[model samples]
Target: MTTHVQLHDRLDYQSVAPLMAELTAIADDMLVIDAGNVRHLGTLPLQVLLSAVRTRAAQGKITRLAHASDNCIDMLGLFGFTPETLTQPEAWT
Candidate 1:
C-alpha cells in the first residue's frame, strides 16, 4: 500500500517530533511525502526524513517527496539535496 504524509508549512525544530512520529507510523511499501506546503526545512526535520527514507529503502520499500514548493526545494538544495536524491538511499551514503 502507499501512504501519504502532508508536510507542515514550517518544518523547523518545533516540527521535528511530530514529523518523526508521523513518518514512523507508516507501514506501507510506498511512502509519499507532500512538500507543497513546506516553506522551511530545518536540519533536524531533514535528518528525520533522510533517516526514514534510508530505513524504508533498507527494508526494500520506497519513500518519495511530491509537489515540493520552491522554498522547500531551495532549502533542500542548501543541504545538497534534491527531492529525487533525498529519497534515494545511495545518495545518503
Candidate 2:
C-alpha cells in the first residue's frame, strides 16, 4: 500500500527531517502527499521534497499529490510545479 504523508503548516528544514525519516522507514510502492493543511514552506523543504519526487520517479515509483489548496498550489507553481501535479483532489461537500 502507498503511504500518504500529511504535512502540517510550516514545512521547513526541521519538519522535513521527520518527514524524511518517515519516508526512509516506509517501503511502500507509492507515495501520496496531502496538502490540505500546509500553510508555509521554506526553500529547503521545497528542495528536499522536490528532490525526493525526482528521485522516486527515476526509480519508477509513484508520487501522487491530492487535496492541495489554491495557495499551496500557487506556492508550488512559484517553485516549478504546475497544476498538473495535483491528481486527485477531494471536493468538500
Model 1 agreement with the true structure over 1-92: per-residue lDDT tens digits: 99999999999999989999999889999999999999999999999999999889999999999999999999999999998999997966
For residues 1-93, what per-residue lDDT tens digits would candidate 2 score against the true structure? 889888777787888788777666656779888887877867877766766776677677777777877777878878666435533222101
The residue pairs found clashing in candidate 1 are none
State the C-alpha lDDT per candidate: 0.93, 0.70
Q: How many times do residue backbones clash in model 1?
A: 0
| Shift in Å, residue 26, candidate 2 | 2.5
**Winning candidate number (lDDT):** 1
Off by over 4 Å in 1: none
Candidate 2 matches the true fold with a TM-score of: 0.78
Best by TM-score: 1
